[model samples]
Target: MSSNPGQEGAVAHHEHESREHASHEDAGIGRFFFGHVPEGVHGGLKQYGLLAIFLAIITFVEFVIILPEDLRGSSIVIAPLVILSVIKFFCVVAFFMHLKFEHGLLWQIFVAGLVLGLIVAIALVLLFGVFRPTPRAFSEGRQQPFVHHVEEAPHYEPLVVPTPAPLGAIAPAPAAGAAAGASPGQQIFMGAGGCSACHAIEGLAVGALGPDLTHIATVAESRVPGQSAEDYIRESIVEPDAYTVTAADEGIDQDFQQGLMVATTSSLGLTDEDVDELVEYLMTLR
Candidate 1:
Protein backbone atom coordinates (compact mmCIF):
# COMPACT_ATOMS: atom_id res chain seq x y z
CA MET A 1 0.00 0.00 0.00
CA SER A 2 3.04 2.37 -0.40
CA SER A 3 2.31 5.78 -1.93
CA ASN A 4 3.50 6.67 -5.42
CA PRO A 5 6.96 8.36 -5.56
CA GLY A 6 5.42 11.47 -7.26
CA GLN A 7 2.84 11.92 -4.45
CA GLU A 8 5.56 11.54 -1.75
CA GLY A 9 7.72 14.24 -3.41
CA ALA A 10 4.74 16.64 -3.54
CA VAL A 11 3.93 16.10 0.21
CA ALA A 12 7.57 16.74 1.21
CA HIS A 13 7.68 20.01 -0.78
CA HIS A 14 4.48 21.24 0.89
CA GLU A 15 5.88 20.50 4.36
CA HIS A 16 9.14 22.32 3.51
CA GLU A 17 7.17 25.40 2.34
CA SER A 18 5.26 25.52 5.63
CA ARG A 19 8.52 25.37 7.60
CA GLU A 20 9.99 28.18 5.47
CA HIS A 21 6.94 30.36 6.13
CA ALA A 22 7.28 29.94 9.91
CA SER A 23 11.01 30.72 9.75
CA HIS A 24 10.27 33.92 7.76
CA GLU A 25 7.76 35.05 10.38
CA ASP A 26 10.30 34.48 13.17
CA ALA A 27 12.99 36.37 11.22
CA GLY A 28 10.65 39.32 10.70
CA ILE A 29 9.84 39.45 14.42
CA GLY A 30 13.48 39.30 15.41
CA ARG A 31 14.60 41.95 12.92
CA PHE A 32 11.78 44.45 13.45
CA PHE A 33 10.99 44.04 17.16
CA PHE A 34 14.46 43.34 18.49
CA GLY A 35 16.79 45.32 16.27
CA HIS A 36 18.59 46.82 19.22
CA VAL A 37 19.56 43.42 20.67
CA PRO A 38 23.13 42.14 20.43
CA GLU A 39 23.94 39.47 17.85
CA GLY A 40 24.63 36.64 20.32
CA VAL A 41 21.12 36.77 21.83
CA HIS A 42 19.21 33.63 20.85
CA GLY A 43 15.70 32.26 21.56
CA GLY A 44 15.92 33.63 25.12
CA LEU A 45 14.68 37.03 23.89
CA LYS A 46 11.07 35.97 24.58
CA GLN A 47 11.98 35.79 28.25
CA TYR A 48 12.92 39.48 28.09
CA GLY A 49 9.36 40.37 27.17
CA LEU A 50 8.07 38.37 30.14
CA LEU A 51 10.57 40.07 32.41
CA ALA A 52 9.56 43.54 31.22
CA ILE A 53 5.89 42.84 31.86
CA PHE A 54 6.59 41.38 35.30
CA LEU A 55 8.73 44.33 36.31
CA ALA A 56 6.10 46.77 35.11
CA ILE A 57 3.48 45.03 37.25
CA ILE A 58 5.78 45.10 40.27
CA THR A 59 6.43 48.81 39.80
CA PHE A 60 2.73 49.50 39.60
CA VAL A 61 2.11 47.53 42.79
CA GLU A 62 4.84 49.36 44.60
CA PHE A 63 3.37 52.72 43.65
CA VAL A 64 -0.22 51.80 44.38
CA ILE A 65 0.23 50.07 47.73
CA ILE A 66 0.18 53.30 49.71
CA LEU A 67 -1.51 53.37 53.07
CA PRO A 68 -4.97 54.82 53.36
CA GLU A 69 -5.13 58.33 54.77
CA ASP A 70 -6.92 57.10 57.89
CA LEU A 71 -4.61 54.15 58.51
CA ARG A 72 -1.38 55.89 57.57
CA GLY A 73 -0.50 56.33 61.22
CA SER A 74 -0.52 52.56 61.83
CA SER A 75 2.42 50.14 61.47
CA ILE A 76 0.97 48.01 58.65
CA VAL A 77 2.71 50.05 55.96
CA ILE A 78 6.15 48.78 56.98
CA ALA A 79 5.41 45.05 56.67
CA PRO A 80 3.96 45.34 53.19
CA LEU A 81 6.86 47.48 52.02
CA VAL A 82 9.40 44.96 53.30
CA ILE A 83 7.56 42.06 51.69
CA LEU A 84 7.26 43.91 48.41
CA SER A 85 10.90 44.83 48.42
CA VAL A 86 11.86 41.16 48.89
CA ILE A 87 9.60 40.11 46.03
CA LYS A 88 11.07 42.77 43.78
CA PHE A 89 14.58 41.71 44.71
CA PHE A 90 13.86 38.08 43.85
CA CYS A 91 12.26 38.98 40.53
CA VAL A 92 15.19 41.16 39.53
CA VAL A 93 17.69 38.49 40.55
CA ALA A 94 15.95 35.65 38.78
CA PHE A 95 15.22 37.49 35.53
CA PHE A 96 17.37 40.56 35.10
CA MET A 97 20.39 38.98 36.79
CA HIS A 98 20.04 35.90 34.58
CA LEU A 99 20.14 33.65 37.65
CA LYS A 100 17.26 31.56 36.34
CA PHE A 101 19.31 30.44 33.38
CA GLU A 102 22.61 30.26 35.27
CA HIS A 103 24.33 27.03 36.34
CA GLY A 104 23.03 25.37 39.50
CA LEU A 105 26.30 26.08 41.28
CA LEU A 106 25.95 29.80 40.58
CA TRP A 107 22.41 29.88 41.97
CA GLN A 108 23.61 27.98 45.04
CA ILE A 109 26.34 30.54 45.60
CA PHE A 110 23.90 33.42 45.30
CA VAL A 111 21.48 31.84 47.75
CA ALA A 112 24.32 31.08 50.15
CA GLY A 113 25.44 34.67 50.06
CA LEU A 114 21.89 35.87 50.68
CA VAL A 115 21.46 33.56 53.65
CA LEU A 116 24.81 34.55 55.12
CA GLY A 117 23.86 38.20 54.84
CA LEU A 118 20.60 37.55 56.64
CA ILE A 119 22.34 35.69 59.45
CA VAL A 120 24.81 38.52 59.94
CA ALA A 121 22.08 41.14 59.86
CA ILE A 122 20.01 39.31 62.45
CA ALA A 123 23.02 38.84 64.71
CA LEU A 124 23.91 42.53 64.60
CA VAL A 125 20.32 43.57 65.24
CA LEU A 126 20.27 41.41 68.33
CA LEU A 127 23.69 42.60 69.44
CA PHE A 128 22.92 46.32 69.06
CA GLY A 129 19.20 46.23 69.72
CA VAL A 130 17.08 45.49 72.79
CA PHE A 131 18.49 42.00 73.27
CA ARG A 132 21.87 43.53 74.09
CA PRO A 133 23.73 41.63 76.80
CA THR A 134 23.94 43.25 80.22
CA PRO A 135 27.35 43.79 81.76
CA ARG A 136 28.33 41.82 84.91
CA ALA A 137 28.10 44.55 87.58
CA PHE A 138 24.74 45.75 86.33
CA SER A 139 23.28 42.24 86.47
CA GLU A 140 24.57 41.66 90.04
CA GLY A 141 23.29 45.14 91.07
CA ARG A 142 25.76 48.04 91.07
CA GLN A 143 25.18 48.59 94.79
CA GLN A 144 26.57 45.17 95.71
CA PRO A 145 29.70 45.87 97.66
CA PHE A 146 32.89 43.87 97.04
CA VAL A 147 35.14 43.28 100.06
CA HIS A 148 38.82 42.54 99.34
CA HIS A 149 41.46 41.23 101.77
CA VAL A 150 45.04 42.44 101.84
CA GLU A 151 47.43 39.77 100.55
CA GLU A 152 50.52 39.63 102.76
CA ALA A 153 53.85 39.02 101.07
CA PRO A 154 55.34 36.43 103.49
CA HIS A 155 58.69 36.50 101.68
CA TYR A 156 59.31 40.29 102.12
CA GLU A 157 58.95 42.93 104.84
CA PRO A 158 57.46 46.42 104.40
CA LEU A 159 59.96 49.27 104.12
CA VAL A 160 59.75 51.67 107.10
CA VAL A 161 59.26 55.41 106.63
CA PRO A 162 61.66 57.45 108.75
CA THR A 163 60.06 60.89 108.65
CA PRO A 164 57.42 61.94 111.18
CA ALA A 165 54.06 63.12 109.73
CA PRO A 166 53.95 66.84 108.92
CA LEU A 167 50.78 68.85 109.60
CA GLY A 168 47.93 67.78 107.24
CA ALA A 169 50.28 65.34 105.47
CA ILE A 170 48.75 62.30 103.73
CA ALA A 171 50.66 59.05 104.26
CA PRO A 172 52.00 57.13 101.28
CA ALA A 173 49.74 54.12 100.66
CA PRO A 174 50.43 50.59 99.47
CA ALA A 175 51.39 50.45 95.78
CA ALA A 176 49.00 47.57 94.99
CA GLY A 177 45.88 48.93 96.80
CA ALA A 178 43.78 49.81 93.71
CA ALA A 179 44.92 46.78 91.72
CA ALA A 180 44.26 44.36 94.59
CA GLY A 181 40.83 45.86 95.39
CA ALA A 182 39.48 46.33 91.84
CA SER A 183 41.41 43.67 89.95
CA PRO A 184 38.84 40.90 90.44
CA GLY A 185 35.92 42.95 89.11
CA GLN A 186 37.97 44.23 86.19
CA GLN A 187 39.01 40.69 85.36
CA ILE A 188 35.40 39.56 85.34
CA PHE A 189 34.51 42.44 83.01
CA MET A 190 37.47 41.90 80.72
CA GLY A 191 36.43 38.30 80.24
CA ALA A 192 32.69 38.89 79.75
CA GLY A 193 32.35 42.41 78.27
CA GLY A 194 34.23 41.53 75.06
CA CYS A 195 36.59 44.53 75.54
CA SER A 196 39.71 42.40 75.72
CA ALA A 197 38.35 40.45 72.78
CA CYS A 198 38.41 43.53 70.54
CA HIS A 199 40.97 45.87 72.12
CA ALA A 200 44.55 45.44 73.25
CA ILE A 201 44.76 46.45 76.89
CA GLU A 202 48.27 45.68 78.11
CA GLY A 203 47.19 44.19 81.47
CA LEU A 204 44.24 42.31 79.95
CA ALA A 205 45.55 41.63 76.48
CA VAL A 206 43.16 39.23 74.75
CA GLY A 207 42.24 39.13 71.11
CA ALA A 208 43.23 42.22 69.12
CA LEU A 209 40.13 42.41 66.95
CA GLY A 210 39.67 46.13 67.63
CA PRO A 211 41.93 49.15 68.21
CA ASP A 212 44.65 49.58 70.80
CA LEU A 213 43.27 51.02 74.04
CA THR A 214 46.56 52.20 75.58
CA HIS A 215 45.90 55.95 74.94
CA ILE A 216 42.28 55.87 73.75
CA ALA A 217 41.15 58.01 76.66
CA THR A 218 43.52 60.85 75.72
CA VAL A 219 42.64 60.62 72.04
CA ALA A 220 38.83 60.49 72.45
CA GLU A 221 38.55 63.71 74.49
CA SER A 222 40.22 65.76 71.76
CA ARG A 223 37.56 65.00 69.13
CA VAL A 224 35.56 67.85 67.53
CA PRO A 225 32.20 67.49 69.37
CA GLY A 226 33.96 67.83 72.73
CA GLN A 227 32.02 65.05 74.43
CA SER A 228 33.20 64.33 77.96
CA ALA A 229 36.31 62.15 77.80
CA GLU A 230 34.95 59.84 80.50
CA ASP A 231 31.53 59.71 78.84
CA TYR A 232 32.97 58.70 75.50
CA ILE A 233 34.93 55.87 77.06
CA ARG A 234 31.92 54.65 79.05
CA GLU A 235 29.46 54.81 76.17
CA SER A 236 31.76 53.17 73.66
CA ILE A 237 31.99 50.07 75.84
CA VAL A 238 28.42 49.82 77.21
CA GLU A 239 26.56 51.25 74.24
CA PRO A 240 28.62 51.27 71.03
CA ASP A 241 25.97 53.35 69.24
CA ALA A 242 26.54 56.35 71.52
CA TYR A 243 29.22 57.79 69.27
CA THR A 244 30.59 56.63 65.98
CA VAL A 245 34.38 56.92 66.17
CA THR A 246 35.61 57.61 62.63
CA ALA A 247 38.67 59.11 60.96
CA ALA A 248 41.43 56.93 62.40
CA ASP A 249 38.87 54.40 63.66
CA GLU A 250 36.67 52.86 60.92
CA GLY A 251 35.06 49.54 62.04
CA ILE A 252 31.86 51.23 63.20
CA ASP A 253 29.64 49.87 60.45
CA GLN A 254 31.01 46.32 60.46
CA ASP A 255 28.41 44.82 62.81
CA PHE A 256 27.04 42.30 60.33
CA GLN A 257 27.93 38.62 60.95
CA GLN A 258 29.86 38.44 57.70
CA GLY A 259 32.09 41.12 59.16
CA LEU A 260 34.78 40.68 61.80
CA MET A 261 32.59 41.43 64.85
CA VAL A 262 30.36 38.45 64.15
CA ALA A 263 30.32 36.81 67.57
CA THR A 264 28.43 39.58 69.37
CA THR A 265 26.58 39.10 72.69
CA SER A 266 23.69 37.46 70.89
CA SER A 267 25.97 34.58 70.01
CA LEU A 268 28.61 35.10 72.69
CA GLY A 269 27.72 35.09 76.37
CA LEU A 270 28.43 38.34 78.28
CA THR A 271 27.42 39.06 81.85
CA ASP A 272 26.33 42.33 83.45
CA GLU A 273 29.52 42.72 85.56
CA ASP A 274 31.49 42.08 82.42
CA VAL A 275 29.79 45.05 80.75
CA ASP A 276 30.13 47.22 83.90
CA GLU A 277 33.83 46.49 84.45
CA LEU A 278 34.56 47.14 80.79
CA VAL A 279 32.64 50.41 80.99
CA GLU A 280 34.38 51.36 84.21
CA TYR A 281 37.83 50.55 82.81
CA LEU A 282 37.04 52.51 79.63
CA MET A 283 36.02 55.48 81.78
CA THR A 284 39.44 55.37 83.47
CA LEU A 285 41.07 55.41 80.03
CA ARG A 286 40.59 59.18 79.80
Candidate 2:
Protein backbone atom coordinates (compact mmCIF):
# COMPACT_ATOMS: atom_id res chain seq x y z
CA MET A 1 0.00 0.00 0.00
CA SER A 2 1.25 3.48 -0.91
CA SER A 3 1.73 5.73 2.16
CA ASN A 4 0.38 9.29 2.13
CA PRO A 5 3.27 11.84 1.95
CA GLY A 6 1.75 14.04 4.70
CA GLN A 7 1.35 11.08 7.08
CA GLU A 8 4.90 9.82 6.36
CA GLY A 9 6.33 13.32 7.05
CA ALA A 10 4.46 13.44 10.33
CA VAL A 11 5.73 9.99 11.35
CA ALA A 12 9.36 10.99 10.56
CA HIS A 13 8.97 14.17 12.60
CA HIS A 14 7.65 12.17 15.54
CA GLU A 15 10.64 9.81 15.43
CA HIS A 16 13.03 12.77 15.39
CA GLU A 17 11.27 14.26 18.40
CA SER A 18 11.53 11.01 20.30
CA ARG A 19 15.23 10.70 19.57
CA GLU A 20 15.82 14.27 20.70
CA HIS A 21 13.99 13.61 23.95
CA ALA A 22 16.11 10.52 24.60
CA SER A 23 19.30 12.46 24.01
CA HIS A 24 18.29 15.15 26.48
CA GLU A 25 17.60 12.58 29.13
CA ASP A 26 20.99 10.98 28.55
CA ALA A 27 22.76 14.28 29.28
CA GLY A 28 23.49 13.09 32.79
CA ILE A 29 26.66 12.96 34.89
CA GLY A 30 28.24 10.42 32.58
CA ARG A 31 27.79 12.83 29.69
CA PHE A 32 29.49 15.51 31.74
CA PHE A 33 32.54 13.35 32.36
CA PHE A 34 33.01 12.76 28.67
CA GLY A 35 31.86 16.26 27.73
CA HIS A 36 29.19 15.04 25.34
CA VAL A 37 26.51 17.72 25.30
CA PRO A 38 23.14 16.79 23.88
CA GLU A 39 22.32 18.63 20.67
CA GLY A 40 18.66 18.77 21.59
CA VAL A 41 19.31 20.39 24.97
CA HIS A 42 19.08 24.11 24.40
CA GLY A 43 18.56 27.35 26.35
CA GLY A 44 20.44 28.74 29.39
CA LEU A 45 20.49 25.58 31.46
CA LYS A 46 21.98 23.41 28.71
CA GLN A 47 24.69 25.89 27.76
CA TYR A 48 25.79 26.49 31.35
CA GLY A 49 25.59 22.82 32.18
CA LEU A 50 27.91 21.86 29.32
CA LEU A 51 30.37 24.58 30.30
CA ALA A 52 30.31 23.34 33.87
CA ILE A 53 31.07 19.86 32.64
CA PHE A 54 34.08 21.08 30.72
CA LEU A 55 35.29 22.95 33.77
CA ALA A 56 34.90 19.90 35.94
CA ILE A 57 36.78 17.68 33.49
CA ILE A 58 39.64 20.13 33.26
CA THR A 59 39.82 20.53 37.01
CA PHE A 60 39.78 16.78 37.59
CA VAL A 61 42.55 16.21 35.06
CA GLU A 62 44.60 18.95 36.72
CA PHE A 63 44.18 17.36 40.14
CA VAL A 64 45.22 14.00 38.77
CA ILE A 65 48.39 15.45 37.26
CA ILE A 66 49.18 17.33 40.45
CA LEU A 67 48.86 14.33 42.74
CA PRO A 68 51.61 12.40 40.99
CA GLU A 69 55.20 12.91 42.15
CA ASP A 70 56.87 13.79 38.87
CA LEU A 71 54.26 16.16 37.48
CA ARG A 72 53.44 18.16 40.64
CA GLY A 73 56.32 20.63 40.40
CA SER A 74 56.88 20.39 36.70
CA SER A 75 56.25 23.44 34.54
CA ILE A 76 55.23 21.15 31.73
CA VAL A 77 52.44 20.15 34.09
CA ILE A 78 51.97 23.53 35.76
CA ALA A 79 51.66 25.60 32.60
CA PRO A 80 48.87 23.43 31.21
CA LEU A 81 47.05 23.42 34.54
CA VAL A 82 47.27 27.19 34.64
CA ILE A 83 45.98 27.51 31.11
CA LEU A 84 43.12 25.06 31.66
CA SER A 85 42.07 26.87 34.80
CA VAL A 86 42.15 30.11 32.88
CA ILE A 87 39.77 28.68 30.31
CA LYS A 88 37.46 27.46 33.05
CA PHE A 89 37.66 30.87 34.70
CA PHE A 90 36.52 32.51 31.50
CA CYS A 91 33.67 30.02 31.07
CA VAL A 92 32.45 30.70 34.60
CA VAL A 93 32.57 34.44 34.07
CA ALA A 94 30.93 34.30 30.68
CA PHE A 95 28.16 31.76 31.30
CA PHE A 96 27.46 31.45 35.02
CA MET A 97 28.28 35.10 35.71
CA HIS A 98 26.40 36.11 32.55
CA LEU A 99 29.35 38.05 31.25
CA LYS A 100 28.88 36.54 27.81
CA PHE A 101 25.34 37.87 27.52
CA GLU A 102 26.14 41.18 29.21
CA HIS A 103 26.74 44.51 27.49
CA GLY A 104 29.87 44.58 25.36
CA LEU A 105 31.53 47.18 27.54
CA LEU A 106 30.84 45.23 30.73
CA TRP A 107 32.27 42.00 29.33
CA GLN A 108 35.36 43.84 28.11
CA ILE A 109 35.92 45.20 31.59
CA PHE A 110 35.60 41.76 33.10
CA VAL A 111 37.99 40.27 30.53
CA ALA A 112 40.52 43.00 31.17
CA GLY A 113 40.48 42.05 34.80
CA LEU A 114 41.10 38.45 33.87
CA VAL A 115 44.04 39.39 31.67
CA LEU A 116 45.55 41.35 34.54
CA GLY A 117 45.12 38.41 36.89
CA LEU A 118 46.82 36.04 34.44
CA ILE A 119 49.74 38.41 33.97
CA VAL A 120 50.19 38.75 37.70
CA ALA A 121 50.19 35.00 38.16
CA ILE A 122 52.82 34.57 35.44
CA ALA A 123 54.98 37.29 36.92
CA LEU A 124 54.85 35.71 40.34
CA VAL A 125 55.94 32.36 38.93
CA LEU A 126 58.88 34.02 37.22
CA LEU A 127 59.76 35.99 40.35
CA PHE A 128 59.83 32.70 42.23
CA GLY A 129 62.51 31.35 39.83
CA VAL A 130 60.24 28.63 38.46
CA PHE A 131 61.12 29.21 34.81
CA ARG A 132 64.47 30.92 35.02
CA PRO A 133 67.46 29.14 33.53
CA THR A 134 69.98 28.11 36.19
CA PRO A 135 73.59 27.09 35.71
CA ARG A 136 74.69 23.65 36.94
CA ALA A 137 78.15 22.16 37.36
CA PHE A 138 78.56 18.47 36.54
CA SER A 139 80.93 15.82 37.88
CA GLU A 140 83.87 16.95 35.73
CA GLY A 141 83.18 20.60 36.65
CA ARG A 142 81.48 21.18 33.31
CA GLN A 143 78.74 23.79 33.69
CA GLN A 144 75.36 23.55 32.01
CA PRO A 145 71.80 24.60 32.67
CA PHE A 146 70.42 23.14 35.90
CA VAL A 147 67.46 21.67 34.02
CA HIS A 148 68.83 21.09 30.56
CA HIS A 149 66.17 18.82 29.12
CA VAL A 150 63.21 20.05 31.15
CA GLU A 151 61.40 23.24 30.23
CA GLU A 152 61.15 23.98 33.95
CA ALA A 153 61.52 21.93 37.11
CA PRO A 154 61.34 18.38 35.78
CA HIS A 155 62.03 15.39 37.96
CA TYR A 156 65.75 15.58 38.81
CA GLU A 157 67.81 12.80 40.24
CA PRO A 158 70.20 13.71 43.00
CA LEU A 159 73.67 14.30 41.58
CA VAL A 160 75.70 11.17 42.11
CA VAL A 161 77.49 12.01 45.37
CA PRO A 162 80.58 9.90 45.46
CA THR A 163 81.93 8.74 48.78
CA PRO A 164 83.82 11.63 50.30
CA ALA A 165 85.81 11.93 53.51
CA PRO A 166 83.57 12.07 56.55
CA LEU A 167 82.43 15.55 57.64
CA GLY A 168 85.00 15.70 60.46
CA ALA A 169 87.42 13.14 59.09
CA ILE A 170 90.40 13.36 56.71
CA ALA A 171 89.90 13.72 52.98
CA PRO A 172 88.55 10.43 51.71
CA ALA A 173 90.30 8.39 49.03
CA PRO A 174 88.86 9.14 45.63
CA ALA A 175 88.37 6.45 42.99
CA ALA A 176 91.61 6.04 40.99
CA GLY A 177 90.48 8.18 38.05
CA ALA A 178 88.29 10.80 39.78
CA ALA A 179 88.51 14.51 39.06
CA ALA A 180 90.97 16.19 41.44
CA GLY A 181 89.19 17.86 44.45
CA ALA A 182 85.90 17.08 42.70
CA SER A 183 84.71 14.65 45.33
CA PRO A 184 81.55 12.56 44.89
CA GLY A 185 79.66 14.79 47.31
CA GLN A 186 80.74 17.87 45.40
CA GLN A 187 79.62 16.31 42.15
CA ILE A 188 76.19 15.49 43.55
CA PHE A 189 75.65 18.99 44.97
CA MET A 190 76.88 20.79 41.90
CA GLY A 191 75.81 18.36 39.22
CA ALA A 192 73.40 15.42 39.20
CA GLY A 193 72.15 16.17 42.75
CA GLY A 194 70.53 19.47 41.62
CA CYS A 195 71.48 21.54 44.69
CA SER A 196 72.65 24.31 42.43
CA ALA A 197 69.15 24.47 40.98
CA CYS A 198 67.77 26.33 44.02
CA HIS A 199 70.79 27.45 45.96
CA ALA A 200 73.64 29.89 45.46
CA ILE A 201 77.14 28.71 46.30
CA GLU A 202 80.05 31.14 46.22
CA GLY A 203 82.15 30.65 43.08
CA LEU A 204 79.91 27.72 42.24
CA ALA A 205 76.30 28.53 41.33
CA VAL A 206 73.83 31.42 41.72
CA GLY A 207 70.36 29.90 41.99
CA ALA A 208 67.65 32.22 43.29
CA LEU A 209 64.97 29.79 44.44
CA GLY A 210 66.28 29.07 47.94
CA PRO A 211 68.49 30.88 50.41
CA ASP A 212 72.10 31.31 49.35
CA LEU A 213 74.36 28.57 50.59
CA THR A 214 77.44 30.77 50.24
CA HIS A 215 77.51 31.09 54.00
CA ILE A 216 75.16 28.23 54.82
CA ALA A 217 77.99 26.55 56.65
CA THR A 218 78.46 29.57 58.88
CA VAL A 219 74.77 30.26 59.50
CA ALA A 220 73.62 26.65 59.73
CA GLU A 221 74.67 26.28 63.38
CA SER A 222 73.55 29.73 64.50
CA ARG A 223 70.10 29.44 62.90
CA VAL A 224 69.12 26.59 65.16
CA PRO A 225 71.42 27.39 68.12
CA GLY A 226 72.74 24.05 69.45
CA GLN A 227 72.63 22.11 66.19
CA SER A 228 76.02 21.58 64.61
CA ALA A 229 76.53 23.40 61.36
CA GLU A 230 76.96 20.08 59.58
CA ASP A 231 73.88 18.64 61.25
CA TYR A 232 71.85 21.75 60.52
CA ILE A 233 72.80 21.72 56.87
CA ARG A 234 71.89 18.03 56.55
CA GLU A 235 68.60 18.62 58.29
CA SER A 236 67.92 21.51 55.95
CA ILE A 237 68.35 19.18 53.02
CA VAL A 238 66.46 16.21 54.46
CA GLU A 239 63.94 18.13 56.57
CA PRO A 240 63.53 21.64 55.13
CA ASP A 241 60.16 22.05 56.87
CA ALA A 242 62.00 21.70 60.16
CA TYR A 243 63.02 25.31 59.58
CA THR A 244 61.17 27.54 57.20
CA VAL A 245 63.73 29.95 55.80
CA THR A 246 61.90 33.20 55.51
CA ALA A 247 62.64 35.31 52.47
CA ALA A 248 64.24 37.95 54.67
CA ASP A 249 64.94 39.99 51.59
CA GLU A 250 61.21 40.29 50.95
CA GLY A 251 60.39 40.29 54.67
CA ILE A 252 57.55 37.82 54.21
CA ASP A 253 56.84 34.18 54.95
CA GLN A 254 55.26 32.80 51.82
CA ASP A 255 54.08 29.29 51.08
CA PHE A 256 55.97 28.62 47.93
CA GLN A 257 55.81 25.12 46.35
CA GLN A 258 59.50 24.87 47.19
CA GLY A 259 58.59 21.84 49.26
CA LEU A 260 59.17 19.86 46.06
CA MET A 261 62.84 19.96 46.89
CA VAL A 262 62.36 18.05 50.11
CA ALA A 263 59.81 15.75 48.53
CA THR A 264 62.17 14.91 45.71
CA THR A 265 65.06 14.25 48.07
CA SER A 266 63.14 12.02 50.44
CA SER A 267 62.98 9.45 47.65
CA LEU A 268 66.28 10.49 46.03
CA GLY A 269 67.40 6.82 45.68
CA LEU A 270 70.79 7.61 47.16
CA THR A 271 72.62 5.32 49.56
CA ASP A 272 73.44 6.34 53.15
CA GLU A 273 77.13 6.66 52.31
CA ASP A 274 76.29 8.89 49.36
CA VAL A 275 74.17 11.17 51.53
CA ASP A 276 77.01 11.52 54.02
CA GLU A 277 79.30 12.53 51.20
CA LEU A 278 76.80 15.05 49.92
CA VAL A 279 76.54 16.56 53.40
CA GLU A 280 80.30 16.74 53.71
CA TYR A 281 80.60 18.79 50.54
CA LEU A 282 77.96 21.26 51.77
CA MET A 283 79.87 21.60 55.01
CA THR A 284 82.91 22.77 53.06
CA LEU A 285 80.87 25.56 51.42
CA ARG A 286 82.39 28.23 53.67
Best by TM-score: 2
Q: Give one digit per residue, the lDDT tens place, for model 2 in 193-220.
A: 6666666777766555677788777777
Best by lDDT: 2
| TM-score of each model, in listed order | 0.32, 0.37
Tell me how candidate 1 scores on lDDT: 0.51
Off by over 4 Å in 1: 1-41, 67-75, 133-286
Q: Give per-residue lDDT, candidate 1, residue 29.
A: 18
Give each model's whole-structure lDDT: 0.51, 0.60
lDDT of 1 by residue, 150-258 (tens): 4554443444323312212221121133346555445543443444445565654534445567667676776537677766765565555445544345345332222
Give the least accurate 10-residue stretch of model 1, judged by summed lDDT.
166-175
